[model samples]
Target: MAGVRAGFSTDLGGRLNVEPEVRAVVDATATVFTDLGATVDDACIDLLDAAEVFFTQRAYDFAAWYGPSLHARPESFRDFVAWNIEVGLGLTVDDLLSKDAARVRLAVAVDDFFTDHDALVTATSQVLPFDASWDYPRSINGVPQEDYLDWMRAATLISSTGCPAVSVPAGFARPAGVPDAPELPVGIQIIGAPGRDVEVLRVAHAVEAATGHGRRHPDL
Candidate 1:
């Protein structure tokens, strides 16, 4: 990460419901970049339309992969999976065209952001880890998560930009006011311009080395 110009953002312009501790970890990670001789600053790319583009493409992919099996035996797949496939199957030509156009706009914005900054950093996840048995978190910080996809907007939004991103272990934190709570792992996301996977990975490697968080494993 030495001499790399890095920009970081805690949230997507207030769109993400990030937990306090999660944001703290990402903030600290940016400091690590500064300490490693990288120029760090708070920067964010506009991704307001990311959800629409991501979900639409996701649904389309799901249908392409599982539509035949779903149609042959509706009960074969889980409810949520089937629902996503059905949504893809029902997409109109105009719907696809609109989302494609929005995706193009997002790509251009990301390209522009990278012109000034070599990489963008952010919280890998909006919230701390949850119980493994639950399908997904119902809410975060009192904000309702409408569906399985809601809680993962942080990563999904980045994905929609067509940039390369890597999530490296940043640190750990416990829930507030829960003295007995176990510390949950947090990650810092490093995003690079399109086709800049090598640069993103280099930054992530530096982060992992400096923090040493990736070396620690949890007890089962």
Candidate 2:
């Protein structure tokens, strides 16, 4: 990882929330079996812990194979990523009526996201790759991602203003005793604290390096 620093961002992926109720019991007694909610929580946690799987598309594709660490750091450090950004919600009188009201407002934002994505999709139709491959094109100038990001924002509506949203590499591991190998590039992400993208990137870099999977490639 020395002298190899890569900046990556994704719009398809976001930190997952396990429903407030499921989170309430993750720390329950060991004697208790994992209930439906607990199982759901575990799955959500696992999914978030596996963010690297989705960080696949980038603005730039490396010339040679990037080490596993270069891909993502698979580790579960926290619940979110730190974002040095601005996030907010503008509420109208309708949304103030009930929780479902928030959904209506959210839909508006989501529609906006779709619109943005569609615009980019249209513009990039000739250039965008429809499948995954090492020779596929890459772009990180922040142009192609507008739409993916729009959808992500609409799906994961932020409660607090731009705060910390982080992603940790979740190394691939299977059920205990299954001897499942680790997926070098797996990452779990968390998002928090806006205006601190540097911090988020720094921490993510360190975690990814420690996961020791960034330098390997599929030989495409």
Q: Each candidate: what lDDT? A: 0.87, 0.28
TM-score computed on alpha carbons, candidate 2? 0.28
RMSD of 2: 19.1
Clashes of each: 0, 61
Top TM-score prediction, candidate number: 1
For model 1, how does the per-residue alpha-carbon lDDT over 20-89 read when each residue is reduced to its tens digit? Answer: 9898877777778888889988778888778889999999999999999998999899888898999999
lDDT, candidate 2, 1-220, per-residue tens: 1222111212222242221221222122111212211111121111221222222211112212222333354242221211101110233334234434434454454344333221100010112122354322233323343333322331233322223455443333222233543322333343323455675566556545554434553331
- Which model scores highest in lDDT? 1
Instruction: Estimate the TM-score for candidate 1.
Output: 0.94
- Candidate 2 lDDT at 193 equals 39
